[model samples]
Target: MALGGNPIFNGKNFRGATQAPPVPQAYGQNQYGQNSYGQGGYGQTPVMDAPGWAAQQNMTQDQLQQMYNRPAAGPAETGRMTYDDVIVRTAACLGAVMAGAAVTLFVSMPLASMLMIVGALGGFVLALVNTFKKQPSPALILAYAGLEGLFLGGLTRILDGMFPGVGLQAVIGTLSVFAVTLLLFRSGKVRATPKAMRFFMIAMIGYAVFALVNMVMVWTGAVQSPFGLSTSIQIFGIPLGVFIGILAIGLAAFSLIMDFTSIEAGVRAGAPERFSWTAAFGLTVTLVWLYVEIIRLLSILRGEE
Candidate 1:
């Protein structure tokens, strides 16, 4: 496991995954006394006219019955990760997010905002905890999702209150972008290449720096605009937030690709089944980021209008 490859697959927890044990090669050449053609190949071969292939191969009747009765091994049975595990876990995380969001969306603004702050702080802590932990904790991942949901709900509420209908627009925008990105990735139009990943890392750092500065500016009352410099500053008469938002959306999309790459690698490498939680967590984090960026962009646009 290594960072920058995909945050989800990084760290000690995933390092254990290696190539799967080789499947037993079928008893190749010829089984028992089976001949090259119709004729018997050799006298030393097991008798072909035996009661069963097992008997011919020297396996006892009990062994034959046990083998026949053995249940087929699945991902769960084999302790290997699978697409279904990822889907179910990711759905669970998103469901938790929605549950938390529902609570904040209907609450008073002050209370909602307070909860939002709590969630943001808690989510950040848990995110770091889950990310760096040698083991993936489902509880922590779900907690992160719930907290993010609260933060998103409060933020969306505030923005929607300021500019009516923007919330709906943002939701649509987020979903549209997500669907398009997924389609592109599945269709092989986009990928997490080394060159693209390098660009993603650089852009992520730059965007993070700007976000930190913007938050400080807003907090210190250095920028009166609701979106801080993103709104106060303009490029060609359009707020800087617009360009930044598009860039952020692209980054989020690329992040999804990275997540996909990690999941694919894990499956191919036969990573442990529990690692699906890691996949789910990564997807949840990326989706939340994407939604926040889309909502903020919509809010900025609406505010300008």
Candidate 2:
């Protein structure tokens, strides 16, 4: 599949995902005898008398030299997305998430539980909105991050209580996985090839089905174990969650690779600077998925121990 196969990148529409960056047009003549700058036509001499052109004609040697010495416009100045833009926006989103999480972390259990529910539902709705919206919205993206933080914080509190220190361990594990995946991508050791994407889609579908069924069973009180089938079902004395958790973490790691690939393509395609928020939002979504998977896996392992 192409780098833009992900729904999160549907707005970009990069042509071939390898098109060269657009070159700025010169002010000189063109095939039609028109000033390529759009100021005048071949039959018009008004462009020569234009104040801006006249000023250029009268420039001092030193002034011309200074103009030549000036640095070229960067991606931001050209109104195109850049890696720096994506980095800054992603940081902002993560900061909002941390702030939201802190709010739930210090609150009473009852209030935190309420906020967790609110956050889960709110985040889900906002995520869908952001994913399908043609244009990226910074405010909504940050709001989604904050809501996810609340859900994560509440979940961590509950899990940490049951498995002391598991929260910190999970955080470390998530960061480690992210760092390793990034390094692999940067080294060109991994990619989202068509074959890999096909496998990823299949696995994702199966995982989603399992998750949905597990959720329903939990709600209907169909399983006595805390994690429903994950704990109740075992293979050779190992809980089913262990295998499922590993698969989930692997999928989340691959998702980070997809995010990286898409963001790189977006930058290369010279997408609108505003789309940096979209890149940031995509990364935040993947990172959240990764963290949740890591934390859940840790909880399951702790439960087993």
Candidate 3:
């Protein structure tokens, strides 16, 4: 998905799913007369439309009353997305990730490395497939999570082995950031405003460019440091990696905000229930990115120590 915003919410689907439905018109005095405001609509007379008193028509008095008093149908009944649906689907995806992560954690080092490569390659491919797909597929989304878990597990194992406790620290950091960001969003202390979004986009582009350059430098042996220019270069005596890592983490957190916004819009617009899978997938992707940045940052900082 487009990292700036959840890529899952893009194109026409994005436009439609996030749109607010038109407000329902209140039935007051109109060309249809005063009874239009009453039960059974404008078609019935005032006496007949009155609750409990409307006994004489095709419907029983109790039936009419029940119909009038029936609570409005929710997203479940209307075949739309809801907070509950998103939560359940997101949980399922994360569960798959954890299960897959456990598999790698218990494997031999060589086997884990192999699985990591496989997972990285497989996850990247599947991520593209799922993001561009018009309709959300439960199978693909879950597969992406599992594959990503494999990769994460392997990476974490390798890093934690070299530097004890870094992995745990990173996990704690990730959770802390997530919890804080979510709390801020819920409390309305943080929001994805247009100005913030514009900044995010510009910063993301610069970060992506830097990441690509570093990858190239590392691959080509231009820099021997683990993180290439990021570690080799320094600004004000602090490794450039530190600043970049913090910035990356910030961007990832803001990305989570965008995901939350999109999901909220989707629910408001009465998006299809199955799209909850889409929401889940988007959230999973963002969380993974956040975790990776956090762990890498921890490793870099610990290395300095």
Candidate 4:
């Protein structure tokens, strides 16, 4: 699955899905006691009946025309993944996330904070499980989305309290980024080429290392700043977080491109319809990452102001 970058569609889970399954054939004996057309029994030639041919000729012109006008079978009919399937499943996942976030909104601050921790930890574990699972599970994927939503909702509540309306701004920013990236991908202006994939992987490794180090510093109380090294360090007169946030946002946006490519490949390869859940899960993960980066960037800017 040289689809580029997304581990979810890296080509393993879709084994034996390179082509659509063979359509079923009707079985019957011809007048000569040979297999009927498409029966192909015992290496014998299939026979078409004269009556069947005559019946086809006897059909009215309008009936024949109507039959000819019928649309061809699509991915759904073939039981393969389709863009529509991906869209529907992705919407369901996002909806579940919203529902989870709503729970945080109605709860008290303490409970919400506790849920944020649970969501963060639970989401991470589910993410890894779903990523490596050979089969996609709708329940697990939806659970992961909901947990992520709780974490986002709690974080947003805290940040919005500090900087009014930043949460809304971040939402808008995230959507804007998603729209622009999708447009670029649709327009064929951007693709996850092999060279680009290599670069992405390298950058991802560097970013992951930095994030882990930052988290460790924060946990150990080595950095009193809210964002650990991001706030404590400065480039020129500006906080380093501003730069880091921008970089993270860029990475997240590119990750969306990767997801789109993988989904397209999966559809083209005739992957099972159930695998659409995997596509949805991948998109949700990237979107969550993008949202967090945008919100964090907005918060850093607000704090600086």
Best-performing candidate as measured by TM-score: 2
CA-lDDT, candidates in order: 0.80, 0.83, 0.81, 0.85
What's the lDDT for residue 98 in model 1? 90
Q: What TM-score fits each model?
A: 0.83, 0.88, 0.85, 0.87
Is candidate 2 or 3 superior in TM-score? 2
In candidate 2, which residue ranges exceed 4 Å CA deviation?
Answer: 1-4, 14-51
Model 2 earns a TM-score of 0.88
Report the C-alpha lDDT of model 4 over 1-305, residue by residue, as the tens digit. Answer: 34356876664556767565644422223333233424356776634554455555676888666655555556676678999999999999999889888899999999999999999999999999999888889999999999999999999999999999999999999999999999999999999888888888888898899999999999999999879989899999898888889989989998999899888878888888888999999999999999999999899888988
- Candidate 1 lDDT over residue span 1-305, tens digit each: 22477665666445666533333322321232122222244575644564344433675677545554554454555667898999999999999999988999778889999999998899889988988887789989999999988988888888888888887888888788878888987898888887887888999999999999999999999999878999999999999999999999999988888888788778777788778899999999989899989988888887777
Looking at model 3, residue 53 earns an lDDT score of 43
Off by over 4 Å in 1: 1-3, 18-72
**C-alpha RMSD between model 4 and the true structure:** 4.8
For residues 34-115, what per-residue lDDT tens digits would candidate 2 score against the true structure?
Answer: 2333356558655666546766667688876665555555566556789999999999999998998899878999999899
lDDT of 2 at 266: 81
List candidate 4 segments past 4 Å from native. Answer: 1-4, 11-13, 18-70
* Tens-digit lDDT track of model 3 for 75-107: 675567899999999999999888878899888
RMSD to truth, every model: 6.3, 4.6, 5.6, 4.8
